[model samples]
Target chain A: MQWLNLLNANFRKEYIEMKRYLPNTLALLLTFYIIFLAAFFGIMFVGDPASFEANVQYSIVSVAFWSLTLMTMNFIGFSVVTEAMRGTLEQLYMSPMGVWKIMLTRIVGQFSLQLVMMVILLFAAMLTSGQWLSLNPMTTIPILTLTMISIVGVSFMIAGLAIIVKQIQAFLQIFQFVLMALVFIPLSVAPFLAFAPFVKGVDMVRMVMMENLTLSAIPLADFGFLLINSMIYFILGLFVFHRCEKLAMKKGLLGQY
Target chain B: MEKIIEVRGINKQYVKRKTKEVITAVNDVSFDVHRGEVLGLLGPNGAGKTSTIKMICGLLQADAGSIHINGLDIKKKRLKALKHISAVLEGNRNLYWRLTVRENLEYFAGNRGLSRKDVKEQVEKLLKQFRLKEKENELVNGLSRGMQQKLAIAVALLANTEVILLDEPTLGLDVEISYELREILKMIVKEEKRTIIISSHDMPVVQELCDRTIIINKGTVVVDEKVENLLKLFETRAYSIKLGGTLSVAQEQQLLVKFPLCTYEGSSHETVVNINLEKSEDIYDLFDIFKAEGTVVESIDRTTIDFEQVFMEIVKGEKAYAMA
Candidate 1:
């Protein structure tokens, strides 16, 4: 009963916040439009419909897979961290709900909205003859899950940093830059990214989007290593958020904002 | 009295990150709020009232202390300890700003796991009770400060917990809103059987709404007594004496020297001398001095004291009471 209540409340809270920031959420949606338009225009220039479709497919998948960190990190920063600085953050911590529940619900809200945008972008890409990377549904699912799990860790870490510094804009900008370059740039470098957990899952994503790699392409040992690695980072991120929560309480900034 | 909330020997200190200078915010403070009662956690600005309230509500984990809500240890069983308590912390009302006033109520009600039907029923009841029905659809940002405060407090009532904690419920409110809030508070106490701890600098809020008051200053409890007892004590000790004629310099100087607590307001239009006697017997010494100085006394009245004046007198060191 309690869990259901929490889940329901979280759903309601997320709905209200999403509704409040409709303009921004729509603006985020426009990023998908640009992706489609680029795919459409790029294909048009390619002249051959088949060539344009493949290029559009590769670009959309690459961008969506790559942009997960920037999207989640920024969303958490604005929605959760900024609210925490404003003292309203105490509303959750002081309630019967655990702090993690609040963090997860807000993140899920970000993911849900972003997921919708990704779908739109994919459709637009399809309309323009764009393609997605090749995938052995089996290898792709587990690997993407690991990558997402790792992204969750990164999200938490960024949220914690924002809490400690009580500043989100500067940190969000820096994280977006570092993540785009450090995390995704290496994957964009080549197929070798699958060997490194930091960029491994992204490499798999890029390869699949290019239709160059599939489930049987990777060793089973590689998947295990990536899972363990992402789990560690996720746990560390959660630990830091807990510590940051304590620090905020100590300062009594929980309500002073 | 069955104590609904007992904070035993709580101590809190904050260390600066750079210099590591520890600032003590609460020092060995202890108090109890009986079941179905309102206890005023009173203090001057910068006093430890807010810190104590925070600790009791589990908002700030105490450095060393045990807070028992219905005798359940707060530190050991935090969630269970908190099940009986709800606090309206300063401006943080546990409310969702983007959510409509009704939605905010529903969200918190759902957080408590109340049935949807019950939640809807209660939300509507609360909106009407708070007189927020007309503006229930308005975004919180659009509400006035006083309305926000009222909504925050109304949300607290929805919790239906055994204890309610309010930090400065009347601060920054206009007189009308303050009166309206007090009426709501009074109604809560009379109609609802829930304990309340109100931390505030607003004396009337304390005097009218609280059965007892615990005044903290400089990280320590300075005064803890029943509201009526303290009011009665102050009344017995304070005096307003009218002189038949203007006082001579020697008499005025002696009055100043002898009773440091006295406020001698000498005017040709009205010669009124006010003094807060240090001891009940001190009034006799005052009378003796007046006789010795040959100052004719027109009339003597033990002034009717207000809690604000009493609070100021205590905080200013002119009135001191031993507290635990």
Candidate 2:
């Protein structure tokens, strides 16, 4: 029940802030839309005509995943930096539910909101390019949910660093491209990247959307691998975050910017 | 009185980034705050007041020693221990400026795991209590600094914690608002009976609101005594004497040698000397200097000392005040 309250409070805060900062939020969506347009035009003008349909479908899914992963993974880090700058980081630390729980609830809240934005962008991209890939919510959601756990874990790691450093904007600016590579690069091209956070889930979701596969149609081992990969990153991310929190406290960096 | 917060010999040190020189921010400091007591943690800048407050809030870790809140060790059971305490740290914008006054209150309460339904009545009470009802829907950024501060404090109160640490609650307010905040705090102290630890340089706030004060200097506890007792201690030793005539050079030299901290001010007809004596007999020594000049003593009055004067004498003297 307490967790529910925490979740509700954070979700409401995220929603209110998004509504209040409507212009900035819309600009962010437009930025993603432009990125998608760039991908669409690049494929149309530069790619082979033989695989034009397949290529456009692939770019649309990749662009949507890229925006989703980039926002989800970087949200907590940016949140921490903003809180520290706004001088509320220490106030958040006063929560008896623990800062990690607050951060987790906030990530969940942000993920939900960003998911809405991602859908809008996905549709916009499809509408502009006149290509629609199968958005198998049933198969894609469960996989995407599993993928998000790993993303949440990695978000904690970034938030931990932000707690100590307090100036990670430059780092985050460069991280969007890293997320883009991770989202667009196929598992077949780099099989070893499966061990990385969210790669397996993204690959699975992409395959499900592009190939129109059901949950049961995918091999059970693939699900098991994705689940284990997420759990490990989730746990590791939490461990790193806790360590960083301790370091921040020890160094008296939690309130510094 | 039951002890609600116990801090034992906590130490905090920071190294300068440029020079890598280790500076002790708090060294071997210890104090206990009793239930329903108001404590003024007073100190000059660089005197470790902030480091001490942060340690108690569990926002900063100590290099040595331990702190327990309601019998839970902060180091080992931090989140559990935090259940008993909340703080509005100095120089920190403790509220969301983008959020409305009501939203900030409800959100902070919610952050502490309390449902909006649970805090609705209390939120209404605090808004009215802080006289912020008219501006409840306004964003915090639009409110005056005093209102923002009041909202920050109201947010802390909504947590329903047994202990609240307010660092410089009246730091930047105008005189009217500062007085208003002091009055609100006094009412809270009288009515709520919650343990409060306020660290501030605002002497009037400390003098009026605090039951006792602990003065820290150079990273160590210099004086720990009750507010009235401190005022009385300094009050008894302070004296203002009016002399009938000017003193000779020899008598002036004797006065300076005997009481270095004493001040002498004079016009053509009269000389006035304000001095704080270390012992009762020191007054006799003062009179002898007057006698040497054959100066008639017109009047002698024991000066009433406020908390600000007492604080200055203590901090400027840099000596541990022995409380009897």
Q: Top model by DockQ, which number?
A: 2
TM-score of each: 0.85, 0.95
Best by lDDT: 2
**Best by TM-score, which number?**
2
The alpha-carbon root-mean-square deviation between model 2 and the true structure, to one decimal in Å, is: 2.2
lDDT of each: 0.75, 0.92
Show where candidate 1 strays beyond 4 Å: A32-55, A129-147, A181-230, A251-253, B15-22, B92-94, B112-115, B242-275, B278-298
Which runs in model 2 stand beyond 4 Å of their true positions?
A: B243-273, B281-297, B318-320
Residue A156, candidate 1: C-alpha displacement in angstroms: 2.0
Q: TM-score of B chain for each model?
A: 0.91, 0.92
Q: For candidate 2, write residues A1-257 as lDDT tens digits.
A: 99999999999999999999999989989998998899889989999999998889888998888889998899999999999999999999999999899989999999999999999998999999998878989999999999999999899899988988888889998988888888888899999999988999988888888899999999999989989999998999999999999999999999899
Model 1 clash pairs are A53-A129, A53-A130, A57-A130, A57-A131, A133-A208, A133-A209, A134-A208, A134-A211
Tens digits of lDDT, candidate 1, A1-257:
76667666766677778778899777866775675576457667865865665556556665565455568656655666556655577666556666666667657656666666666655655555534445455666667777777777777777776666766687666666566555535444565654433577766666665666667777777678788878887898889877876776656656543
C-alpha positional error of residue A229 in candidate 2 after TM-score superposition, expressed in Å? 0.2
